[model samples]
Target chain A: MNMSRIVRSTANILFPFILVFGFYIIVHGHLTPGGGFQGGAVAATGFVLLLVAFSPDIIRDKFSFNSMKYTEALGLLLFIITAFVAIALGTTFFFNWLANGGIIFGESVAFGANPGILNSAGTIPLMNVAVGIEVIGAMGLIIMYMLSGIEGGNKE
Target chain B: MKSKEILTAIIIAVLAASLLLPSALMVFGSPQNDGMDSYMIDNGQDIAAVNNIVTGVVFDFRGFDTLGEALVLFTAVLGVTLMFRRMKEDEEYEYE
Candidate 1:
C-alpha cells in the first residue's frame, strides 16, 4: 500500500535533517558521543523512513542493490587502505603515524579539555567516515533485500 | 499443580539470578582496571589526537576488532542476500 500524502510529505521534510545530523555524528565522531556505527544507523533511519513512505520498488530505484553493494565494498576498501597507509609510511598497522607530523589531520591535541578543532585526530576521523559509509551501505542493503523478499512473497 | 508451578518459577528465578548476578553486580572495567583503559585515558589524546577516548580505542587501539566486526556484518549481509536470492517476480510461493 502506498503511504498517504501526509506521510510522504513528513518523510521528505525529515530526510535531509536526519542526514545532516548523522553526518555530523560521523565527522565529529572523534570528539563527540556518537561515532560511525551510531551515525550510520541514524542515516539508515532516514532511508527507512523513505522506504516506508513509498513502495519498495519506487525506493529501490533510488537505492539499488548493486549500488549499495558497491558502496559497501568501496567503504571497506577505504577503511583497509587507511589502516595500511601507516604501514606504507614505515609504521605498524593501525599506527597513529600522522599525529604531530604537521600534515593533514596531524595536529597534536592538547593535554586536556579545550575547544576541539575539526582538523584534529589523525586517521581516526578517516576511519570514522569509512566505517560510517560501510555501515550505511551495509544497513541499506539489508533493508533493500528484505523489501525485495516481501515483494517477491507478495507477488505470488 | 499450582504449588509445583510456583516452585518451578522460584527455582528459575534463583537460577537466573545465580547465573547473571555476579556479572551484573561487578563494576565494569574493574580488576584489570590498572591496565589498557588508564593508559588509553591518560595518553589517548597525544597518541591518537582524538578527544573521544572511546573512538581512539575503537579505531586506533583495537582496530583489528573493528575490522573483524565489519567483516562479520559483511558476512551477515552476504548470508541474508544469498538466502533470498533468485526469487523471481510472479514465481509461485513454494510450500513444503
Candidate 2:
C-alpha cells in the first residue's frame, strides 16, 4: 500500500537529491570524509525511503531484482579486476600503480597540504567507485528481500 | 535464585571492568604505536595522491582488507537471498 499523498510527494522530491548526494560522496571520496560504503548506504537509504512510501509492486516494477543482483556481482568483479590489473602491470596486488603514472588519475601530488584534486588518487578512486556500486546493489537487495518476506507473511 | 542473581551481578561487574579498564589506562586520541601512523600521515598523500589519508590507506596501502570487507558484504547478500528464496519455495510447496 502507498503512504499518504504528502509522504509520497515528499519522498518523490527528496529521492533525486539523495541520489545526487550519494553519487557526490562516492565520486569525491578521495577528497572527502565519506567513501564507497558510506555513500552507497546513503543511496540505498533513498531507495528504502521510496519502498516505504510506495507499494512494493511499484518498486518491483521500477527496480528489478535480477538487475540488482547483477549489479552487485558486477561491482565486485570490477573491484577484483582492478586489483588483478595491478598484478598484470608487474606490481604487488592492490598496489597504487597509477598514482604517479601521469596517466588517468595519475597527477603527482605535492608533499603537504593543498586543495584536493578530483582527477588524482589513481586506482583509489576507481576502487571506491567499484565498491560503491557493489554496496548499493548489496544493500538494496537485502532490504528488498526482507520486504518480500514481510509481504509474504502478510499474505499468510 | 539469590545465587543466580549474585552470579549475574558478578558477570556484569567483570564485563564492565574489562571494558572500562582499557579506556582508563590508555591516553585518549594517542595511539600506542605512532610509527606506522606517522609514516602514513607523512607520505600517504604523496604516494596515493589523495588529500584524504584515510582513503589512501584503506584503498591503497591496505586494500586487501577492503577487498575482504567487500567479500563479506557480498556473502551476506547471498545468504539473505538464499534464505528468502527457500522461504518462497516452501510457501509454494505448501500451497500445492
Candidate 3:
C-alpha cells in the first residue's frame, strides 16, 4: 500500500541522509558510541521508511530477496575470513594482527588518552563494516518477507 | 476464582520483590569484579587501538561472542524465510 504524496516525498528526501548517517556510524564505530549493529539498524530503518511510503511491489522490484541473501552471505564471509586471516598469519583466531603492524588500519595508539585515529583500530573497523552489511541485508529481508506474507494474506 | 486472583497477585508481587531487592541493595557504578573492566580500560587502546573500549572488547577481546551474535541473527532470518517459503508453497498447492 502506498502512502500519501507528502510521506513518500519525505521518505525519498530523507532516505539518503539516513543511509549516510548509518554508514558514518558503522565506519566510526571504533571511536563512537554506535557500532555495526546499531548503524545497520539505522540503515534498515531507512529502507523501512521507503517500504512504508511505497508499495511492496515497488520495493520488491527494487530490492530482490535473492540479492539481499547474497549481501548477507558476503558480509558473513568477509567477517569470517578476516578472523581466519590471523590464523594464517601464525596468530590465534581473532587476533588483532593488524594493530600496531604499521600497515592498513595498523597505526599504533599511545597508551594514554589522545585524539581518536581512524586508521588505528586494526580489524575492528573491518568487522564493523562486515556486521553492518550483514545486518542491513538481514533486516531488509525480514521486513520484505513479512510484507510479502501480509500481501499474500490480503490476496486470499 | 477470587482465590486464584489473589494467588496470582501475590506471586507477581513476590517475583517483583525478588527481582528488585538485589538491585536496590546493590551499588550502581561499581561492579562486583572490576579486574576485567580495569584491564580493558587500561590496555584496550594499546591492544585494539580503538578509542571506544566497548568496541574493542566486542570486536577484539570478545570476538567469538560477536560472531555468535551475528550467527544468531542470520539463523533467525533463515528461519523466517523458510517458514514463509513453506507457507507460500502450501498456498500455491491449494490453488492448484
Candidate 4:
C-alpha cells in the first residue's frame, strides 16, 4: 500500500466521525465551553485533512468556492434576518425575545437543547450553528485553494 | 489598520509601564457607566435574553460589528487572490 492510498483510506474513515463530533460541539455549545467559532474550525479540519491527503483538483471538484461564497453570504443573511425579525416584532435589534422558552415543532427545547441548562439562550444557539456552518465552509474553501498552490496546481 | 495600530500602541504602553513601575499604582481607571455593574446583573438577562452573558454582549448587543469583523479576513483573502490573478494574466498577455 502506497502513502496516498493509505492517507485516502484514513481520511475517508475519519471524516464522518469528525463532522458528527463538530455538530455535537456546536449544538451543545451553550451548555459547554465550545461554540460556533470553535466547532466551525473543528468541522473545517475534516475538509482540510481531505484536501491535504487528496489532490487539489479533487478538492475543487468536491467543494467549489462559488458554492462556499453563497453559503457564507446566506449565513450572514440568515443572522441578519433573524435579528430583523426581532426588530420587526417591536423589540430592539438582535434581541433574544424568542429565546427564553419558545415552542418549536410541538416540543420545548431550550435554545438548542431540550430541558437543559443550554436551553435558556434563545436564538444564540441557532446563530452559533449557522455561523459554524458558514465558517467551516469558508475556511475549508480558503485552505483548499491555498493548498492547491503548494501542490503544484495552477487551476483553481 | 487602526486596530492593529491601537494594539501596537497598547503593547508599547504596557512595555513602557513595566520600565516605570511606580506609575502602575496610580493607573487605575474609573468605570465609564456609573451603574453598569448593578444594571448588568439585574437587567442583563432580560435585555439580551441569552443565558450566557458573554453571548448576549457579543451577538445581541454588538452583532452588527461582529459581522464586519467576520468578513474582514474573507475580503482580504479575496483581494489578494484577485490581485495575484490579475498580475499573472497581465504577464502572460505581455509574453504573447
Cα RMSD for candidates in order: 3.5, 4.0, 3.9, 7.9
Clash-forming residue pairs, model 3: none
User: Tens digits of per-residue lDDT for model 4 on B1-96?
Assistant: 699999999999999989888665554665446586656545656554544555555666667775675677457557645644424444654444
True contacts kept of 2: 0.88
Off by over 4 Å in 4: A1-6, A105-115, A151-154, B1-38, B45-49, B80-96
Task: Assess the local accuracy of residue A88 in candidate 1 as a C-alpha lDDT between 0 and 100.
Answer: 96
Tell me each candidate's TM-score.
0.86, 0.86, 0.87, 0.71
Please tell me which model should have the higher TM-score, number 1 or number 3: 3
What is candidate 4's lDDT per residue for A1-156, written digit by digit as tens? 123788999999999999888888887765566777788888889888887787766666677766767776676667677778888999877776566445431113323323345555677777777778777867875775565455355255
What C-alpha root-mean-square deviation, in Å, does candidate 2 show against the real structure?
4.0
Residue-wise lDDT of candidate 2 within B1-96, one digit each (tens)? 599999999999999999999889999879888999899999998888989998999999899999999999999998998777744454654544
Docking class of 1: medium
Looking only at chain B, model 1 earns a TM-score of: 0.65
Pick out the ten consecutive residues of candidate 2 chain A with the lowest summed lDDT: A147-156
| Of candidates 4 and 1, the better by lDDT | 1
Error of 3 at A122 (Å): 0.2
lDDT per residue (tens digit) for residues A1-156 in model 1: 568999999999999999999999999998889898899889988888887778875775577788889888888899999989989999899887776777988888898897887788888888889989988898888777777766432111
- Per-residue lDDT for A54 in model 2? 87
Residue-level lDDT tens digits of model 3 in A42-141: 9989998987789887776688888989989888989999999999999999998888888999998887777888998999999999999999999988
Pairwise DockQ winner, candidates 1 and 4: 1
Give fnat of each prediction, in order: 0.77, 0.88, 0.79, 0.21
